[model samples]
Target: MFVTESFNRQLDDLLERICSKLQISSAQHRLAQDRYETIGNWLGARESPLAMFNPVIYPQGSLRIGTTVRPCSGQEYDLDLVCEVQLDWRQVERPVAVLDAVEQRLKKYDTYKTMLERKKRCIRVNYANEFHLDILPACPDPSSGTTCVVVPDRDVRGWKPSNPKGYAAWFESRAKTFEVYLAEHQEPLPSQEPVEMKAPLKRVVQLIKRWRDLKYADDQKIAPISIVLTTLAAEHYGGQQSTSEALAGILAGIVASIPPRNQRLLVLNPKNTKEDLSEKWDENPDAYEAFVSGIIAFHQSWQDIARGRGIPSVSATLRDLFGEDLTKSVVKEQAESIQKARSEQRLHMQKSTGILSGLTTAGSVSVRSNTFYGSQEVLP
Candidate 1:
C-alpha cells in the first residue's frame, strides 16, 4: 500500500491533515465512555460486595489527557480506569487482595467473566469491537497526600503509588497555558472531557503516539509506552502556535533528553515524584534505545512531510511513518478539501513555505492550475 506512484501536489497541509485523522471521533468517544460507565455503575452498585468501600471508577492514561489516538483502522482502544476503593492502605494485609477482589467481583458476572483477562497490574475487560477497559484496583494513598493511590503490583507482590488524577491535572495545566479554540465540536464527558480544540501539546503527543504504533505494530515490546512519550512531550513542550512547530520542538526535546550510555533516562511521574514512569526502561534497555531510534525516525519522516513536494512522495513517506490505510485515506481527504477550496476561490498558499488548504496567509499568492488542454501546471 505504499503510495508514491504518481500524484503531483504540494504537501503543506500534511501535519494538520494527520492531526484530523488521529483523534477519536465524537461518537467513538461517547461509545467508549458509555461502555466504561456501565461497568463503573455495575461495580459501584449498592448490591455489590464492595459498595461499603465507596468505590469509584474513573479514566486514566491517554483518555484522561485528551490525547487518545484513534486506534489503527480496526484496533482496540484501551480505556485505563482506576477502581479506587476508599480504604486505608493498611486495611489490606496483602496488597494483592485488592486486585484479587476486583477480579473476583468482575468474574461474578457471566459476560465480564468471559471478557476478563488478568494482567500484572489490572483486570482487562476486552470488548469484541476495538475497545477494552483496563481497571486497576487501588486504595487511597494517605501517606502521599491528595489524589495519590496505591494499586497492587502483581510482579512486586506489593502496592505501587500512582496519581492518575493528579497526572491528568498536571497535563491539563500545561495544555491550558496555550489557549486554542476550534470551530469543530468535541464530545464531552464529566470525568475526562476530550479537548474542544486539541492543544498543540496534545497534538504533539498524539502524533508521537501514532508514529510509535506504526513503528511497533509487530514489535510492541520495543515500542515506547504512551505514558513515557506523553510525559516527555509535556515536559519538553514549549507553547508554539503551530502544531507542526510544537511537534518538532517536542521531538527535539525528547531526543535531547536521552542520557549517556551508562545512565538510564529517568522519567518520573509529575504527581508522584517517588514513582518513575520510565521504570520499564530499566527492565529492557533495548526498549529505551528502540524508543530513541523511533523518535529519530519519526522526526525525519515528519521533516520530510513538511518539505514534501509531490503528493505521492508524501503519501509514501506517510505510509512508512504511519500505516498505509490511514495515510491513504487522509491524503485523499486533504486532496479533496484542497480541490474544493480552490474551486470556491478560497485557497491561498502561506508565504512561509507552507501552502495550506483554505487558510489565507498575509502576502499570500493566488493558486491556479495552468491547463490549456494538458499544459504545464502554474506555481502559486
Candidate 2:
C-alpha cells in the first residue's frame, strides 16, 4: 500500500474536507439557532401555560456534540432540542400532558401552528429544505439530580430517562482529552484552528452517520440509531490523532464490543445506567444483524481505502462508501485546491514519505514551479 506518515496525513486532510462538506453550513446553523432561540423564548413566555413552571429550551443531540451531518435525502436537517420545565416528576398531573402543553403552546403561535407536526416523542417544526426543530418535552428526574430528565414516550405512555446534557458533556470530555494531548505535543487543536476544522473523533462520527444514512436509506428500520453510533464511537474512542485512525480503531472496538448473535446488544446510556440506548434492537433482531453486517462492511471498505493511492482511486472507494455525487464534487474541489497551492509555490512534498500538502513540514521540499504540462502531472 506504500502508506507513510505523509500519505496518511494527506488522506486525513481529504477525510477532513469530506466531513466538512457533510456538515451543516454555518449559515444553516445560524438560521437553525435563530429559529430555536425564538422558539425557546416563546415557549418560556409569561403568556404560556407552562411559563409558571419555568421552562428552559436548549439543544441536546448532534448539534450540541458538533457531530451533526447534512441530510443526504434532500430532506431537512434535524436540530434536536429539549424543553425542560421545572415540574416535579413525582407531582406532575400527567407525564404525557407535558407533551400536550408544549404542543398547545406552539399551536397558539400561528407560525409554529403551521409548522408543527406531532410525533411520539417530539413536536417537529418542519422548515422545508433548511432544517427541522424537534422539541422534546421533559421534566426533571429527582432521583438522578439536575442532569437527569424524564421525557414523554407515547409508545409506553410513560416518561423515559434521558440525559442529553450529561451525554454531551461526556463526549466533550472524551474529545477534549485528545485536544489537550495535541496542544501539549505542539499541534494546533481543533478548537484553536479554523471553525471548519473538527477534532478527529467528531469527524469520524460525521462520516459514520453519513455512511449509515446512505447505506440504509431504504432500510431505515434496520439502521442503527444516532445515539447508539455516537455513544459507541465516543465510548470506544482512544484519542487517535487522525479521522482515519480513529475510525478504524472505533470500528474495531465496536465490533469487539458486540456479543455473539444469541446474546443481546446492550448499549446503555452513559449518563444514566438504567437506560439502554439499543433497546430497540431487542425487538428487531434483524436490526442488530443489519447493524453488525453494515459496520463490518464499512470497516472492510475503510481498510480498502487505506490501501488506495491517488485521488481517482481513493475517490472511487469513497464514492462507494458515501455516494458518487458528493465524492465527485469533493474530489474535484480537492484536486483544484492542490493545483492552486502548487501554482502559488506553496505546496511541499515530504521527502521521507513523498506526501504533497500545502502546509510545510519537516524533511519536506517545495514543489518547484513547472511549465511542462505532460511531464508535470506526476501527482495526478
Candidate 3:
C-alpha cells in the first residue's frame, strides 16, 4: 500500500538527515584532494621517468562517481586513483615494472616512504585517521583508444585491463536517462540543475553501503564489496528523487535481478566485458547469500516504516536497520518537530474558535468525532 503523506514526509526528513551524516565533511574533502594533487605533482616531476610519459593522475571509483561515504568506526575512507601514463605497452615488456617504478618514486619522498605499501593491484598510502589512497599505475590500451588501460596485478602476476572512466561515464548516462524519464512523466526529476546537484543516486548508494557495513560488521571479509553493490543499484535505479524511496527501489530491484542459488550471478563491468564485478560470488557462495539476506532485511525494515506505524515502532525498526545512535537522533528530531506542530496547531485553534474547553493536555485535541486538531494539518 502507498504510504501516507505524513509518513512519507517523515521518511524523507530522516533520510536527508542520514545522508548528511554519511557524507564526509568539506574539510575532509579538501584534505584528500590536496594530498592527491601533491602525489600527482610528485609523480610528474621533470626529473622522474614518469614525467617523460606525461602521467595523468585522476580518481576512478567512488570518488569520481560522487558516492563516497564516511568510513565506519576504526575504518579509513578508501581513495582509488589511477596514474595513467602515455607509454607504449609493446616497449614495456614487463607491466609490473610500471608499478615498481611508481612505488620506487613514491618511496623517494619522506612523507610517502613510511605510509606507502605495495598491494596486489595498487600502491596503498595510508593517511592515519583520514583515508588511504590506492594508486594504480596504468598504461593506455592502444586497442581501446584513450578510454581503457592495462594495470599490473600482483595476484595474477599479469597485466589486467580496466576502463574505469568508461564505466563511470556509462553510469552517468544511465542517471541522465532516468532523470529525463522522470521529467517526461511529470514526476520530480532527481535534480533540475544537474545530476550532481541532488545526488539522489549517490545518497542511495551510500545508505546501502552503510547498511552492508552494519550487517556484516563482524564478518567483514564476507561482506559484499562496494563496487558490486554499486553496479547492481545503478543498473536498477529509476530516478527516485528521495533517498529513502530510491533505496527501496534499488534494494527490491537488485534482489529481483539476482539469479537463483544454483546459478552464478555475472555482474560484468559495463565498460569491459573481461572484468566481472561478481567474480568473488562464484568463489564464495556464502558471502553472496549473506548479501541477499541483507537486502531482504533492509526491504523489510523499509516496509515497516512505510506502513505508517506509530513513531515508537517505526523508530525501533529504523534502529534495527541503522544502529541505535543514528536512529535515536533522527527519531528524536522528528518527534520534536511533530510536537512543535501540534503545539502550534493547538494555539491556532484556541485563537480561532475562542474555545479551549475541549482541548486535551496531550497537545492534540479532538475537534470533532474522529479528527484531531493537529493530526490533519500537513506541514509544508
* lDDT top scorer: 2
What TM-score goes with each of the models?
0.84, 0.89, 0.82
Model 2: lDDT equals 0.82
Highest-TM-score candidate: 2
Estimate candidate 3's alpha-carbon lDDT, on a 0 to 1 scale: 0.76
- What is the lDDT for 327 in model 3? 76
State, as a TM-score between 0 and 1, how close model 2 is to the true structure: 0.89
**Candidate-wise lDDT, in order:** 0.77, 0.82, 0.76
lDDT of 1 at 208: 81
Backbone clashes in candidate 1 total 0
lDDT of 1 by residue, 1-380 (tens): 11111122233245556777787898988888888888898889898888999998999999888889888755677889989999888767888888888888888888887899999999999989868889988888868968898889999988888889999999998887556333233334356754355688887788788888888888788888899989999998887756767877887787777787788779989999878898998899899888877787777777776565466655687788767777777867755655666666677666665444455558776567422332222333
Model 3 quality (TM-score): 0.82
RMSD of 3: 6.8
Model 2, span 209-258: residue lDDT tens: 99999998887889899989999999989989878889989998988887
Of candidate 2, the 10-residue stretch with the lowest lDDT total is: 371-380
Q: After superposition, which runs of candidate 1 have C-alpha atoms over 4 Å from their true positions?
A: 1-12, 180-196, 304-315, 348-380
> Is 1 or 3 the stronger prediction by lDDT?
1
- In model 2, the Cα lDDT at residue 40 comes to 94
